[model samples]
Target chain A: MDLSRISVVVRMRSARQAIDLGFVMACAWWKPLFLSWLIPSALLYFLLTVLFHHQSWVAIWGVWWFKPLLDRAPIYIAGQALFDVKTSPLQCVKALPQLYKSDCLPWLTWRRLSPSRSYDLPVTVLEKLKGKARQSRLRQLHRENANAAICLTMVCIHLEWLLTLGAVGLALLMIPEEINVASQAWFVPQEGPMLWVQSLLSYFAMAFVAPFYTMAGFALYLSRRIDLEGWDIEIRFRHLAAKQARKPAAGLAAACLICFFAGPSFFDPPVWAAEISAQNKGPKSGSASSRAPEYERVKKQILEILAGDDFHKPVMTQGWRLKKRDAENPNGAALPEWFIRFVEFLEQNNAGPNRIAAWFGRGARVLEFLMWSGLAFLTLYLLLRYREGLEAFARNAAAKKQQGHPPNRLFAPDVRPESLPEDVPTQVRRLWQRGAARPALSLLYRATLSKLMHIGDFVFHEGHTEGECLAIVKQSGEAALCDYTMRLTLLWQALAYGHHAPQSEAVEALLTQWEALFQHGQ
Target chain B: MSRIPLDTQYQVETPEGIDLEAALAGPVVRILAYAIDLILRSIVLTVLMIVLFFAGKTGMGLFLVLSFLLEWFYPVLFEVYAGGQTPGKKAMQIAVVNDDLTPICWSPALVRNLLRAADFFPFFYLGGLICMALGSKFQRLGDLAAGSLVIYREPPKAALSLPNRPPRSPQLSLSLEDQVAVIAFTQRHGQLSRARQQELAEILSDVLPCGSDQAVGHLQGIGIWLLGDRGETTSL
Candidate 1:
C-alpha cells in the first residue's frame, strides 16, 4: 500500500510483513480459492474412501495428505493477483479442470510429494513446465529461494496439523456425553456419523488454513523472484519511463530552455533568484536596474580583502628534533647515564651514508633470499603433504574428459577386467580345491570387482579401499551381489593380512554361494 | 520459475584482507538435517536397548541417562568441535556458523542447542516452526538469540568455459557492467534451458548482428574471449 517505502531494490522482508501480505492476499480472494480447495478435497476424500473401501483411517489421513494438491488453487489466485487480474471465486472454481490439468497432476505424483515440492508448487502451477525444462527451472528457482519457500511450507504444514488437532479436540469437548460413551467403548467412536463428523472437522480445519498456507508459499516465491530479477527496480524504472513518456513535450521544452541558456551560471537558479528578488523588494529609492555596479563593488571589496598582506603571510613554529635541540633533557631533568652513553656512542660512530647503505643493503639481500627460500620450502612441503589429494583431483578431471569410456582399472591396477578368467566360479572352485586358498580368494575378489565394474556399471578409481568398494556396491542397489562381495572381501582380507584362514568346510560353502551368485548374474 | 536464491552468502572480511562467503541454510533443509539426526539418535537408542537388554534395572538407568545426555548435548558437542556440523548436518551438506561467518564457538552452540527446549514447546516443534517462518535468514528463536547461522556447505563450482571455436567479439563494445552480465550469462548457460537461454540473448539482439539463436553462441564466444581463451586460432 505504501509504494514510497517500497524500494527500487528488492529488500529482505520481515517474517511479519511476509505473512501479513500473504494473509491479505488470501483474504482478498478467499471465496474462489476456498471453493477450489473444497471441491478437490471432497473429491479426493471420496476417491480415497471408494478406493480403500471406506477404511476410516485411510480416508482421514489420505485427505489430510492430499491438502498439498489443493494448494494449486491459492497459488493460482496469488499469481493472478501479481498481474492485477481479480478473478471471482466462482470463476476460479470453474477453471479448476484447467488448473488440475496444468498444475495439480504434475505435483500430485508420489515422487514429487516432498518438502521441496512445497517450493516447487508455485513454479509448476504458474510456469506449467514439463520434463527437462521443468527440471532446469526448478533447479534455478531452488538455487535462489529454496530456504524461504521450504520454511514457509513447513510452518504452514505444522499450523494445519495443529489446527486439525485443535478442531478435533474442540469437537470432542463440545460433545462430552458422546465422548464419555466413546471412552466407555475404549475411546473408539461408533462406526457411523461420528466418523464423518471427525473427518469433516479435519477437512474444515485444513480448509481454514489452506489459503494462508498457499498465500505464504506464493509470497515467498514472489519475494525470491523479486530478489533474483530485481523486479522492484524494474517496476520503478518502468513507472519513471512511463511518467517521462506521458510528459515528453514538457521535458523537451525544459531541454530547449536549458540549451538556449547555454551557460554554467544558468544552471544555478538559487543565487540569481535570490539576487533578483532582493533587488525587486529591497530597492525602492535606488535604481534596481543598475544592480550590476553594486555587485562589482562587492566583488572588488572581497578581492581586496583576499589580496591583503595578512592573507599570504607565513607564521614561524618550533618543535624538538635531534639536530635542533640541545643534548640536555628538554624537561630540565638530568638524563640517565645509559641514555647519555647511547647518544655519545651514536655521535662517535657516525658512519658515512655509503657504509650504512652497504650494511643495510647486504642484510636486506640476505633477508630477501631467506624469505624466498622459506616460501619455496613451504610450497614444497604443502605439495608433498597433499600430493594424494592433488593426484586424485587430476585423475577425476582426466576421467571426466574421457566421458563415456570406463576407466582402465576397476578396483586396483592388478584387478583389470582383462585379467579376470571367463569361468570365474569354476576356476575359483578348482583353485580352492587344490589347497591354494589365498590365490583362489584373490581370484574371486578380482572376479567380483570385474562384475561390479562391467556388469553393475560402478565406477572405481585407484585409491578406493575394499570397505569403500563394499559401500559403493551396497549403494548401487545390487544387494545380493554386495553381500557376496562383502563376505569375499572380508575373508580375503583376513586370510591375506591377518593370516586367519577360515575352515575348509566354510570355504567350500562360500565357494558354492559365489558360484550361485555369478551364475545368477549370467 | 526463476532460480530461487536459497542460500544467503554472508561475506566477512578476514584480517588477511580477503573475503570469505558463507552460504546460510534455510529452515527446510535444516528440518531435513534434524530428521536425519533424529533417525540416528533413534538407531543409537535401539541398539543400546538391545545390547543392554540383559542388564535389567542398571541398564535401564544407564539408557535413561544416555538418552537425556544425547537429547540435550549431541548437537552441541558435534557443532562445537566437528567443524560446526553434527553428523546429520554433515550429511545434509550444511554447517552452523557464527553470524560473522566464523566457525561457531562452544557457548553459542550450547545456547542454540539448549533453546531447542523452547523451540519444542506446545508439541512437535510448533514454536520453532513459527519463529523460523517469521524470522529473516530462516532462523528460529534459538538461532536469533545465539547469533548464529546454519549454512549450506557447497563446494565452489568451476567457472564454465565456452566451446572451442574461433573468437568472436561483440558488434558493439560493451561497458564493464555489461561485460560482467554477458560473462555471467555464459557461465550460467549450462543451468538454463535452451529456450530460456535464447530468450535472454534476445535482449541484446539489437547490438548483435546474428539472430537470437546465433546470438547465444556469439555471446558465449565473446565470454570465452573475455576469459582469455581465443580458441585454436584468434579471430579479429
Candidate 2:
C-alpha cells in the first residue's frame, strides 16, 4: 500500500508501445530463454543436417520457423511470470509444455500464420478470445498500438541476419585451411548440393537468435496491455483493497470476541492502571502536576552512584611507558628480555669498524662495475634498435643549427603547397618585370619549400630555417635541382636582407632555370 | 484505473540531511554506450593479436590469458576504480552509482559485471535490453541485483533570467502553481526559439489583459514582478 512508490502513467498502449516494452524485457530475460530454447533448437537443426547428409535452405527455414512453436510456451510463462515475484526462469521452463498445449495449439489456424499475429498473442493466450471477437479485438488493439508489432518483427529479423553473418565469419576464421581449400569448389555460385555445409552453418546461427524474436514480440504485447489498461495501477489498488477487507476479521474483532468468552476476571484493569487511578484520586494530585522533585531525586541518586570509589578505579593495570634503560636496567619498559638479549648477542658478534669498512668498499666497487656495464649494454641495445630514427633526428638538429634563423622568417604560415598557381614561372616573371624584386624572389622561395616538402620526402620540423631547407635539399642528392635552388637562395638573400635588388636579366635567368628544375623533378 | 507516470529522477536523502537527485539513463542511451564499449574491445583484441603474432607458442598462451582477463574483468576494474565509468560510459557522459546515489563500491561493481553473463543471454544482450526497458529506473537484471543505477553525469542547467524591462503587476491574480509556471516560462526565454517563446506565452494569454501578440512582453513583466522587482505599474 505504498502509494507514493506506484508509477502514475498507465494506459492502453499501442503495438509500438508494446514493442518498446518488449525490447527491454527481452534484454532482461535474454540469457535463460536463449539457453533453454534457442540453443537446443540450433543443436537439433545441426543434428538433422548431419543425419540427412544434405545442406538445404529447407533445413535452415525449418529451424527458423520452428522456433515460434518452441518459444510459445516460454513466452506465455514469462509474460505471466512478469507479475509474479517468485516465478523463476527454471519454473517457467518446467511449466512450458502445459502452457504451450493450453495457449498455442488452439490458435494454429491458417489466418494466424502471419508474423503480425505474434503481437496479438497475449489477447489470444491470456484472454482466450476467438473468431470474430478475436479479430475485432485485434483490430482495435492494432488501431491503438500502431506499428509496434511490425517494427518488432523487422528489427528481430535484421538482428537475426546480422547474427547469422557473424556466425559464418567466426566459423570461417576457425575452419582448418585444408577444409577451406576442399570447400572452395562448392563456394562458387549456383552449386546447390555442394553448399550444404554452408546452409547448415546458417541454420545453426538462426537457431541461436530465433527465440529472441518470439520473446520480444510477447514482451511488446504485455507492455501495450499495461499501457492501455493501467495494469500496474490496478494491481496496486486491488492489493490495497484486499488487505483492507482482511484486516478486521484477522485481528481486532476476533481477538476481542475470544477475550470476552474467556472470563470476567481476565477483563479486569491491570495493576499499573489501578495504581495510577489511586494516585489521581489523592490530594497529592497537585504534586502530580510537577514531577520536578522526582527528577531531582533521581539525578541526586545517579550523582551519588557515580561518586562511589568503584567508579574512580582505573580499568587498565598494565601498559607500556617510555623509560631510559641504563646498564643497570638492561631493558626499556617497551622492550622484552629476549629482544634485549638478542641485541647484546649481535653487538658481541659485530666485526671491527676498519674490517667492516674494507669489506663494504670491496662490495661497493663490484656493485659500481655491474651498474656501469648494465648501463652500457642498455645504451648499445637502444642505439641498434633505433639507428635510422636517431640519424634523421640528428641530421634535422644539425641543419637547424647551421641555418641560424627560423624557417618561418622566410615562409609565412599562410603559404600552403597548393596555393601556387599553375603558371608559377610566368607569375614570377611579371612581378620581376614590374620591379617587384623581393616579392618575386619570395614567390620562388615559397614554391621551392612546397616542392621539397611534397616531392623530396624531406621531414620538416617546426622552426626549420632557410639554411636547414637548403642543407636538406643538398643532402637529398638531386644535383641539378640543388644547384638551381642554391642560385635562387643567394639571389633572394641579396634582394630581401641586403636591399640589393637583382637586375631584370638575372631574375629572368633564375626563373627559366627554376621552371626547368621543377619539370625535371616531376 | 489511471496510468502511473514514469519516474526517471531518483531522490536520495543522505545522513547529512541533503537530497541528491540522479537522472537515470534510459535503454537507448545505455545501448549506445554498450556498442561503443564493444567496438573498443574489438580494437584492443585486434591490436594484441597482431603484436603477439611474432611471439610463437608463449605469445599465443599470453594472448589467450590477456583476452580472458579483458573479457571478464575490464569493466569491473574500470568501474570500481575509474570514477564509476568505463571509457565508453565516460564518452556517453553516464556513470554507475549506488541505489542511494553514492559512488559505487567494489562488491556491487563485481556483482553487476559478473551477472553480465546472465544479461547477455540468447545473443547480443537481449535479456538485458528487455529488462532495462521494463524496469522503472531502466535497470537491467544485473543492476537490480547489484543495487546500482546508471545515470546521466551532468546536472540540468538553471533557468535563464527574464529580460531587463521595468516590472509591472499582473492584471489578474494567479494561483501559486500558475504563478510558478509563468515565472518558469519567462526563465526559459533564452533557450527557446523566438517563435516557440511567443507560442508558449500566448497559451497563457487568457490570464493577461493583453491579446496573444502582446503576451510575451506581458509575461516577462510579470516574471520581473515575481522576482520582487516592483516598480511603477504599467498597463499593456
> Against the true structure, whose DockQ is highest?
2
Question: Best candidate, TM-score-wise?
Answer: 1
Q: Candidate 1's residue-wise lDDT over A1-522, tens digit each?
A: 322233122443433234434554565556766777777888888888788766677877887666656778778876665555666767787866776677455455663557655557787788878778888877777776566666666766666766555555544556657445553222345686666666666677677777767776666666666545534433443343344356566554444333223322432333334333454557443655575575466557656866898678978889875652435547444667788776677557996667768877999999999999999999999999999999999999998888868766654636666887877868877988898888888887877787778877898777998888888988978777777788888888899889987777767777788777766657
* Candidate 2 chain B, run of 10 with poorest lDDT: B1-10
Off by over 4 Å in 2: A1-522, B13-19, B155-164, B169-180, B190-206, B209-213, B225-236
Going through the candidates in order, their DockQ values are: 0.02, 0.05
Q: What is the TM-score of chain A alone in each candidate?
A: 0.44, 0.39
Report every candidate's CA lDDT. Answer: 0.67, 0.64
Worst 10 residues of 1 chain B by lDDT: B1-10
Q: What is the DockQ of candidate 1?
A: 0.02
Model 1 lDDT vs. the true structure? 0.67
* Count of clashes, each model: 11, 37
Native contacts kept, each candidate? 0.00, 0.10
TM accuracy, model 2: 0.35
